[model samples]
Target chain A: MTATRRTTDTLVIVIVMLLVWQALHQVAGSTALPAPLPTMIYLMHAVASPRFAENTTTTALELAYALVLAYAIGLAIGVWMGAHRLSGVVGEPILVALYSLPKITLYPVVLLIFGLGISGKVAFGALHGILPVALLTMGAIRAIPPVYLRSARSLRLSPWQTIATVLLPATLPEIFTGLRIGFTVTLLGVLLGEMFASKSGLGFLIINDMSLAQSEDMVTVAIILFAFAAIANALLLWIEHKLHRRV
Target chain B: MTRVGAIRFAVIVGMIGALELACRLGLINHQTIIPPSEMASTLVTLLASGSLNADIARTLGEVMLVIGLSVVLGFAFGLVIHALPRVREALDPFFATYYAVPIFIFYPVLIAIFGLSAIPIVLIGVATAIVAMIIATLNGLDRVPPVLAKVARVHRLSPVTTALTLQLPAAAPYLFTGVKLSVSYGFIAVIAAEFILSPTGLGRDIADAYADFNNRRMYALILFLLIVATVVNGVLHALDMRWAERRSGGRS
Candidate 1:
């Protein structure tokens, strides 16, 4: 299909969906099921409110800091493991176990150690983010063509030169994949922490509104968050597409 | 034992021993980090007490229900979406971006609509899990080779027969992959729901333990959860491998 046709199709579908939702709201006539128009209005107001700005910044900042820490440590460890045979073998099982293990189960442990604040949330998010990056980085390095390494060695290139010219470039794609997955889980981890225990942030806003029985406000917060997440994911996917094309 | 096995065993033992030593030497606070021995004893005590059994059963039942529901609904959704090219194209972007949105965010809305009960919790799990199955199922069906369709037509098979005999078998692997992903995703979603919303279940108990600062119980519950997750994943992986082997053998 043409790009314009696809865009038109999507818009039509979205409109139909919204109409159906609005119809349901009208039929239900429940406070919980606010019509989309009203919900959108509430969302607009919420967006403009200082409170939303503060919470948005708080959540974004938390995610940013956690992701940065996770990226640095996870990249270093993953690269180290990828470079070393024995260390990778020793760590592989533990990494796999931790990967499958719902890291949310460790939220309580984090809370205990870091106390109830952004520190705990950041720690939890970083923990969630690290594993995927580490695993992917290890796989990427391991999968690098042995011929390239052999050739590099034959050239008598220094270790730094070898990594710069070969390993780093070769592993960039997989590293991007890891970053994408890590960003997602880190976002979830932080949100989960905030929901479980927090004084502020989007999660807290949702929980707080729910308790207060403010359905409109709650939906508004959810909408804002949903938009933020959807946009972030789309951006990452676009970057990946561009990078893949270049490669 | 394999070299890797020996190394893993050493790592675990070394970490636990280090923690135990730290506790004994008063270098680590018991309030923050419970010794491995104490955690083991607590696990034993909790098992003997039988209090954990009901919680485990409840969580398992909820997760099983969610996975079952997700499989059925997701398959249907996939079939519909796949059958309609325009619909699929229209929603493709949303579906692609959907996974990153923490479906947990919908819990409050669900609770508001359904009230504080198992209904909302189960709904949350199903909602979170169904998307993966849908994507997988669509991909599975899309992968059905055109040659197989031609073969079915040559045999004068009805569309229904063709789907049952050809398309399904061809798509079985992808469907199984969908189901496997659904099971694990459902497990995670259900546990998370229990933590935030449910009044009872293993997650609630863990939350309660955390609140009370019962480090031993908290660690013990987490350990049990880890075991369950690992065993389930291991079983699914084995099943996947066996299925692959059988398929390859049949092809050979």
Candidate 2:
């Protein structure tokens, strides 16, 4: 499809979504769900508030910490397992099972260990992110063509050189995909941690508004999160596509 | 068992044994986490007591309902979309970014509209799961080879007959993938919804136990859920592998 057509289609979807929101608001009543226009207006003011800044900063910092830990640890595990065949064979299924399991059940244990603080949220977010990164990075390494490694060996390249030249570029696209997914899930994990227990952050703000019957504020936060996730994903996806094309 | 399987079992056992030793030796705090053995025993006792039967039943029933609704509705929507190229093109971006958006954030909005009831929980579950099914359905339909259509035309078969006999069988593997994803997503969403806020269910019971500092009960419930998720996933995975093998074997 042409770029213009795609843009128009996206615009149409946005309009349709707004229309649906309005119709649902009508049906559900203003108390339950404020109309889209007013919610958007509320969101603008809310974003300008100091409380929003504080909570958003808290969530962003947690996400950043979690992403760094997740990437570092996950890449280490992935490289070790991927390079060692036996470990990969034994560990892959275990990782897959962990990935599939609903990890929210373990949040209580996380809470107990880390306490009701930012560390707990960061740990939980990292827990959500680590598996996907490790799994994908492992797959990427395993997929490296044997001939490339053989050539690297034949050239007498040192271990560092082999990884820098042959290993990195070959796996960059897939690793980037892993990072993208890791970012998405880690954000979710942080938000969920906040919603369940934390005293601040967008998730907590949503819950607080819910309890206070502040429908517009709650909707506004959800919309902001939705928009943030959508835009971030689109940007990452575009970069991923470019990387794939280069490869 | 194969060598890898045996080694995998050993590794898992060793890890659990190490954790058990740590818990027993006070290297780990008992207040924070109970030993695995204690968790198992507590779970067995809890099951025998029948105290959690209602909650278990309620949670499982909601999951099943969510799965049924998502699969049926998602497949129907997928079929409609696949039949319309324009609509599919328009929806492509939405599908791509759907899971990234943390649909659970809307759970509160759902609760507000539907009230704090099963409706919101089920809706959230379906919302999380249905997209996977729809994407899988689209993939399955797209892979139905042109030769199948040609064969149907040559044989003068009805559209429904062609769909049932040729398209359905051809698309079965992809459809099964959809079911697998839907099941996992459904389980996660429903439990998470209940965990966040619900009147009653396994998730709620676990939350309540945590709030009351009932470590044993919380650990037992957690173990139960982990076991259930693993077993269900293992069975589905095995079936998927068998189907994959059969397909490759037949081709060879």
Candidate 3:
């Protein structure tokens, strides 16, 4: 797979996929499988909408708040659970149960509790977001060998002192994995909540377009989401890489 | 057994019981924080009325279809990539990029392609699953040390034979891990897609409950959702443990 061959391979896959789409559209009709050209057209129309910008910003703001809050809460719990076996036992299963559950199923309850506002999105996002970080953190902390802790204890280090000097430094790399997973999930939570129930947000905009049969606008909003995800992931990856390199 | 597990179960149940009693005793707003007793009644009604059953069945059908297709296609795709070393290297970055790109972003695209239907819901589920499966397979390939590959070459082992014997078994741990990961993510992806894009199923039922402000019913549904999560997780965990034992040379 040289660059040229890679390009050809990609092109072939795309062409074949598009051909299949075209065939499906021809057979099933536009109501079901609207061809690529129409989708692209709809996306172009959607990008030109003033409301799209505002909605996208609203979603991003909610997502940011959720991610930050989840990071803080999950990191604290995760570190504690990781450092202590008792806490891990009491907490880890709960975290997993929460994470494994169809979080969207909680959307109704969240909506009732938080109302349909940015706060609701943030709250729901955090609920969906925190478990991964907490689990990951607990795991990383647990992975640190007991010998290091014993050595610190032998040196008569205080609990806090051991955590600060030994565990913290040793587990920083693994802890970052929790952060990365937590952030990605926070975004997903925000997006899903917004899409399902919101007055403003990129997800809401997409849903709105769909209802109005504005396929192009729906496509555009989708594209914006794609761009947002790309930027967010790249940023997280860079941060993770930087931290790893520094340590 | 783990004393830790026993204690945790007690603690969790105690918390639930405490919360239920407090709400019942008016230590909290019973309406806002419905007691488990009331929630359980609501649950009975929902199940009796066939709403939960229908919703779960509908959602499960779509998810199962997606999982079935993805497993088959994913394994095939993995095999193809393994067969073509250069192609695997070339596709690696693209796979990583797509994997990092959250599948929720594609919800709108799904709707555009399939409308508010189960097809889009299932397609996105499969898509979310694909990257993880591929990664697991690729990771399995890494278990074949370079030395082993060289030896295999010297001994003239067919690529197919080498793959069936060495690569897959070596990859079993990772593949199982990937399965666990994919199922969980796939669960969320399907529900989220349906919640956002489709007009039916569990997500819709939950959303409708919110819109209607039926708190008791909502609480009931959430409890059931929690049950589903716990059961699925337990199953996955048991499977992982079994595989781990077998993989560790039958230490169990």
Candidate 4:
């Protein structure tokens, strides 16, 4: 397809989707559903609100805490486990069990344990985020090139030295993959915590808006969250790509 | 079993037994974290009474619906992207953008529009699966060996047969990998959806239990959900391994 036709097709999809949304809004004719334009207006209004910065900052802080903790812990355990096959297998089953457990169900346990505080949210976020990182890092460590081990040994490197120089470098790509997965899942977890377990996060804002029947305000917040996610993911991807190239 | 397997098994059993013993001996709090005996008894009771049994059925019903829909819709769109280069190129960026834009962001809107039903959950699951499927199919196409393409040409195979038999089979492993990943993620997405907005199902049950600070109830619900998720995927993994073994033997 030519660029023009491709662009047109894209526009068609976007415009058509919006038009349908707008048409439905018109038919509803209630505050329950705002027209596309009205929603956009509300979105702009949300952006202007000082509360936008506060909510966004709250989510960002919680997410950073969760992501960092998950990565640090997952990497340490995953590297150790992945270094040995037997350990990997035994540990993997337990990890998989924990990982697959509908973490949402644990939120109650989390809330109970941590008592509706940031501690609870961060703990929940780290739990959601940690498993994939560990698994992915394990996968990465397993992929370490054998020739590097041979070379390191030939150079008379100690076990620690070999691991630091050869294994760590080789695992960087996979480690990044784990971190990316951790970020995505952690964001989800953090958002859920904020929504269900908090009084002030963006999630709280959303639930509050919904309860108040502030439909447009809710959508605005939702849109901003989506935008933030997109930007965060894009930034991570760029950094990962740069790291891969540099390494 | 091999000695190593037995040792591994022993280690795991010992760990669990130790934990149970700790709780029993008052080294751990059974109320805060139930002893294994208590947890097992709870499971047994719930299963016998059929309340938990029915709850599993309820949650599993919705999960199955989502998975069923994802398989159909994911493959349909995936095939379109695979076969049609024009369509694939045009939609690629949109898919990439969508991936970055957290689907959870849509939950509030979905609940508003659909009102906390299974439909919204399924939609989220299916949507999560779609891009993964398309990427898998596309990547699989690119993975077809050049030698295989030449062999297909030499055999004078029709284009359709080449796609179905050669390309699809070549892509089979990756396709399976994609589906597996998608299903795992799709399940997570659906559960999270329920946890976020639903009025019923496992997610809602957990939230309710949390609100009451009933650790036993909360832990029991989580364990139950874990078993369901693990059993479903474990079964799928077994099927996949069996299929691979048969195929490898045939090739040999």
Model 3 residue A90 distance off true place after TM-score fit, in angstroms:
3.0
Where is model 1 chain B poorest over a 10-residue stretch in terms of lDDT?
Answer: B159-168
Docking category for candidate 1? medium
How do the predictions measure up, each by TM-score?
Answer: 0.93, 0.98, 0.84, 0.86
Write one digit per residue (lDDT tens) for candidate 3, span B155-226: 798977776676666677877777776777677778777766578887666666667877787788777766
Kindly list the per-residue Cα lDDT of model 3 for residues A69-183, writing each as its tens digit.
8989998899788767888877777777777777887776677668778998999888877898888888888988889989998999998999899988778877887887777
- iRMSD (Å), candidate 1: 1.7
TM-score of chain A of each: 0.92, 0.98, 0.81, 0.88
Q: Pick by TM-score: which candidate is best?
A: 2
Kindly list the interface RMSD, in angstroms, of each predicted candidate in the order they appear: 1.7, 0.7, 2.8, 2.8
Ranking of models by DockQ = 2, 1, 3, 4
TM-score of chain B of each: 0.88, 0.95, 0.84, 0.80
Point out the higher-scoring one by TM-score: 3 or 4.
Answer: 4
Residues B136-162, model 4: lDDT tens digits: 777777788989889889999987788
Which portions of model 2 miss their true places by more than 4 Å? Answer: B151-162, B250-252
Instruction: Give the higher-TM-score candidate: 2 or 4.
Output: 2
The per-prediction tally of clashing pairs is 0, 0, 3, 0
- DockQ of all predictions against the true structure, Cα-based: 0.65, 0.86, 0.49, 0.45
What's the true lDDT of residue B95 in model 1?
83
Residue-level error in angstroms, candidate 3, position A169: 3.4
Q: Candidate 3 chain A: minimum summed lDDT over ten consecutive residues — where?
A: A27-36
Model 1, residue pairs in steric clash: none
